[model samples]
Target: MLKRKIEIRLRPDGEIEAEVKGFKGKKCTDYIAFLEELLEAETIDSNYRAEYYEQEVLLKDENKVLESIEVIPESILKASNKK
Candidate 1:
């Protein structure tokens, strides 16, 4: 079983930061798209964790595998968008 988590932090300077965990590959990005759009934020830099490189096997006999995945935390994206 795979678990998805999102952690959000508010800074003293009125900045928001978000961290995503347990999301494999592009799913993390897809999950946060709505938040980014809602906050009118743009992504500046992205760091993919080791988990992102992990490949998921859907079926053993079928040999079906998912593609490489990467995700950007919300807080990092918001910080970069600030100028």
Candidate 2:
């Protein structure tokens, strides 16, 4: 997984400033593009580092491991309901 830190600072002039660190390549800029779009503001400035494009892909596999499980009865759910 890629690790990075994003800092947002609100200035006295009502301007918001953002800084991204530990990310490299176009990854940092590309990732933050959504923020600018969400806020409906143009990017005034940006700085990029080289580590942003690298990320580890985790392999997730599911295996059925069945074991005896006990479940609480439906009467408990009705008893806990306030309405």
Candidate 3:
């Protein structure tokens, strides 16, 4: 499983900085958009780490696989049907 993490720090000078970890390529940008918008922050600079180039990394073990799945609660589905 791939883990995603966001690190936020407030500097003594009242400047806020955030670092997105465990996300590769442009995907990392998605995690920070909401915070940036809420703070009305203008990006002064962006540095892409080495991991960004490897958007997805597969393990060496042939049996290992990653898949995307979505689950919706039955109650929510029933309620939506009644609308």
Candidate 4:
């Protein structure tokens, strides 16, 4: 399992700043959209961190597909080449 955290800062000028962590690719934008609705806040500016360009990784249970050839890279290659 991966750890996810959101760091929020409230400035004296009534400004809200948030730093989202652990989410990769476009997932962060989804969170931002949620925040906009939840806080009724409009973003004045935006910036992308290094994590923005990374691929989103999904965790799956191995037992669910233990007998599936899709789990094996070599098997997938051989199956595709056969066609």
Candidate 5:
């Protein structure tokens, strides 16, 4: 399971900004709606990070974020693509 997080900031002008992380694809949208209703404020603007476009690939009892990354060689990647 992804370790999801939401960082919400209350601006000086009382504008609310929330950055939702670790939720793949459009999963963050549900939280946005919840915030809007909870705060009784209409969202005037929104932005998505690159992660927002990625769909979650689930593996049972697996978390995708590795404790360490193992770099793959370009040659290996190219060879795999040919198959």
Candidate 6:
């Protein structure tokens, strides 16, 4: 799993600052978009390293599994792509 963390700092002057860590690739932009919309804040600047463009993904195939009941793995059930 990609580890993600966000920190918020509220200054005495009512300005807010957010720090996002541990996100890779366009994931960082996705994270920032959600946070900015949630807080209605404008991003003044961003700092990113080469690692920021790398993404972490996990894939699993569920056709093979031992089950006692009609159980489905959470990952398969909650897959973002479904028709």
Best by TM-score: 4
User: Candidate 5 regions off by >4 Å?
Assistant: 58-83
TM-score of each prediction: 0.55, 0.47, 0.56, 0.64, 0.62, 0.57
Task: Write down the TM-score for model 3.
Answer: 0.56
Comparing 3 with 4 on lDDT, the higher-scoring candidate is 4
Best by lDDT: 5
Query: What clash pairs does model 4 have?
Result: none
lDDT score, candidate 3: 0.66
Q: Which regions in candidate 6 have their CA more than 4 angstroms from the true location?
A: 57-83
Candidate 6, pairs of clashing residues:
25-52
lDDT by residue (1-83, candidate 3, tens digit) is 45878787778996788877877656777766766887777666667665555545446787453542333446867999999
- Cα lDDT, model 2, residue 27: 48
Q: Is candidate 4 or 6 superior in lDDT? A: 4
Error of 1 at 76 (Å): 22
lDDT (tens digit, per residue) of candidate 1 on 7-75: 777769866677778866566667567667866775555676767655454666786654443445678
* Model 2: per-residue Cα lDDT over 1-83, one tens digit each: 23577787878997778877755445466657876876667787665433444443324574332332233335755887845
**Residue 60 shift from truth in candidate 4, angstroms:** 8.2
Q: Report the alpha-carbon TM-score of model 5 versus the true structure.
A: 0.62
lDDT of 4 by residue, 13-67 (tens): 9999988887766778898888788778988888977666655444475433122
RMSD of each: 10.0, 16.5, 11.8, 10.2, 8.3, 13.0
Query: What number of clashing residue pairs does each candidate have, in the order they appear?
Result: 3, 4, 0, 0, 0, 1
Give candidate 1 misplaced runs (Cα > 4 Å). Answer: 60-83
In model 6, what lDDT does residue 42 have?
A: 79
Error of 6 at 28 (Å): 1.0
What TM-score number comes out for model 6?
A: 0.57
What's the CA error at residue 47 for candidate 4, in Å?
0.8
Instruction: List model 6 lDDT by residue over 1-83, tens digit each.
Output: 33678988989997888877876556677777888898888777777655465544433564432322233445656794573
